[model samples]
Target: MFGAVPALLTYYWCMKMPETARYMALVARNAKQAASDVSKVMQVEIEAEEEKVDKIGTASSNSFGLFTREFAQRHGLHLLGTSVCWFLLDIAYINNLFQKDIFSAIGWLPKAETMNAIHEVYRVAMSQTIIALCGTIPRYWFTVVFIDYIDKFTIQLMGFFFMTVFMFALAIPYDHWLSNSAGFLIMYSLTFFFANFGPNATTFVVPAEIFPEKLRLNCHSISAASGKLVAIVGALGFPYAAQNKDPSKTDADYPPGNGVRNSLFLLGGINCLGIFFTFLVPECKGKSLEEITGEKEEADANDMQQASSTQTFPV
Candidate 1:
């Protein structure tokens, strides 16, 4: 109830916003509308760069469209890069999320049978809040602070490497940490931290930057869809693999986990593979969106120069 209200209300504000300059200029190819939107949003006049785009008549020349040979040679790699990284990152992240019992096993949370349904819900909420405060929230700020300074590629690489280390650290001595709640909590939380500060954020940011605006939304949707698909598969498959065979055994030790351990090890290996995939996504930090996409660079620059020349800057 607390979080849901604000989230629902936010759509009203978002709906109020005009179409972005990127979509107007790049996708719609309506530079006058794009410039007018910029002027409206910024409360200033902006010169329309339609003349340059008109001169090039790129729409006529590049009739091959998104699936063309030219597009494949130019941007197919970036499409693959964004898709694979998002897929790998979400598979691990969502699987970790679905396996929420790890937190209940830790020291702070009370056993379920001891608490009533309401109390259990309250406790779960409180625990998640604490985890967000300690691990999830801080790491987001960490990424925002350093994503520009250190660059997106390095952050993503370091995140996967550390996630592998932490997952292995937790999985290798699973029984030991099972009894040692503080140790398990620390290791588990570190994975959560790195996932946020690393690939999770980068996956979203890079796609928007690397792909040309015309195909940007398509690439991001495809990449995001792939991530969700794998996440569902992993979530469904891992539990089945971890299911208990013995009638007398509890769910906790069911994996006794030569089988259960497989999931953790699999996720760790997935992160290990992610390090290699991260290389496919080029570093875009400190570069303009124009430089990264390199589609119609001359025309894109003319649009910016035209808009910038007319718009007054703060001294």
Candidate 2:
């Protein structure tokens, strides 16, 4: 598990690595420094783009360091709220997948010799494959659109609320021949659907918005690590909880579907808690990435003005 986690963390670190000279010039407030960082990382010399520097270097204002400012107090609260929401979302989302038996949950599968058990396992494995095919891959599109057009906080909250409704549907028993089948599809669809549009996307976006430049990368990494911590704890414990039937009990006591159902209920409660927490984040969409970083535009303007003045005069 530790090995797998570092592999995952490596992917995120790469994604968040310093990339653009544009971000660097604005964040570092020094064309020379920005060009140096870019050249080092990109493995090529970059001429200082003098016209592009914002002068104040406030573009990089996003950092975990901002929490100390009076102005940052409100955003700090939002970050804290979003962090909790992210933690719960990770727990529930992963627990649902674990319940599906993709992780080889301990003692859950029937003995290899039982044809019925083998058939059931194969059916579920195939069904889950089809579900991932239809539901998981296309989510990128919805995330791009919603993160751009919708209120991010509201979308995340709605995703959790709707998940609760799907859980309620699963908890109820219906008489129709296809009722359980329909319910499962609806529930799974909702799960993946929101994954694209809600907390899954928002959690990543929020840290980028709220922090100042110097601390942004480190804090975002920490936030991601925290979420993963929640997921790891659940992953380790859920299988044992789901499959361990009392040795003395009759065969009927531990039904095949019972563990999955219980796991869903556990996730449903976490989703509810997540919705309540979403209210804390500020609406940061439409703000320039620099402004979100907490850079002062006026300071940037003044610095540029002085630089221009310096250029006009004799040395």
Which candidate number would show the highest TM-score if scored against the true structure? 1
Residues 46-93 of candidate 2: C-alpha lDDT, one tens digit per residue:
888666564444333333254467435635666677678778878877
Off by over 4 Å in 2: 1-18, 26-29, 33-55, 58-74, 101-113, 116-121, 174-179, 244-259, 297-315
Q: Candidate 1: TM-score?
A: 0.81
TM-score of each: 0.81, 0.68
- Scored by lDDT, the top model is 1
lDDT of 2: 0.64
Identify the runs in model 1 with alpha carbons over 4 angstroms from their true place.
1-8, 55-64, 96-99, 104-116, 244-247, 250-260, 296-315
Model 1 C-alpha lDDT per residue in residues 1-315, reported as the tens digit of each score: 799889878988898878888777766778999899889889999999886645444643223367888778877887888889899898788655534455544446676667898997887787667667767989978987888798989989999999999988887887787679777767777898999999998898888888776677788899999898998887766665554344343254445333435567878998998898888888988887767766457666767988989998789
What's model 1's lDDT at 111?
A: 67
Model 2 CA lDDT for position 241: 49
Candidate 1 local distance difference test against the native: 0.76
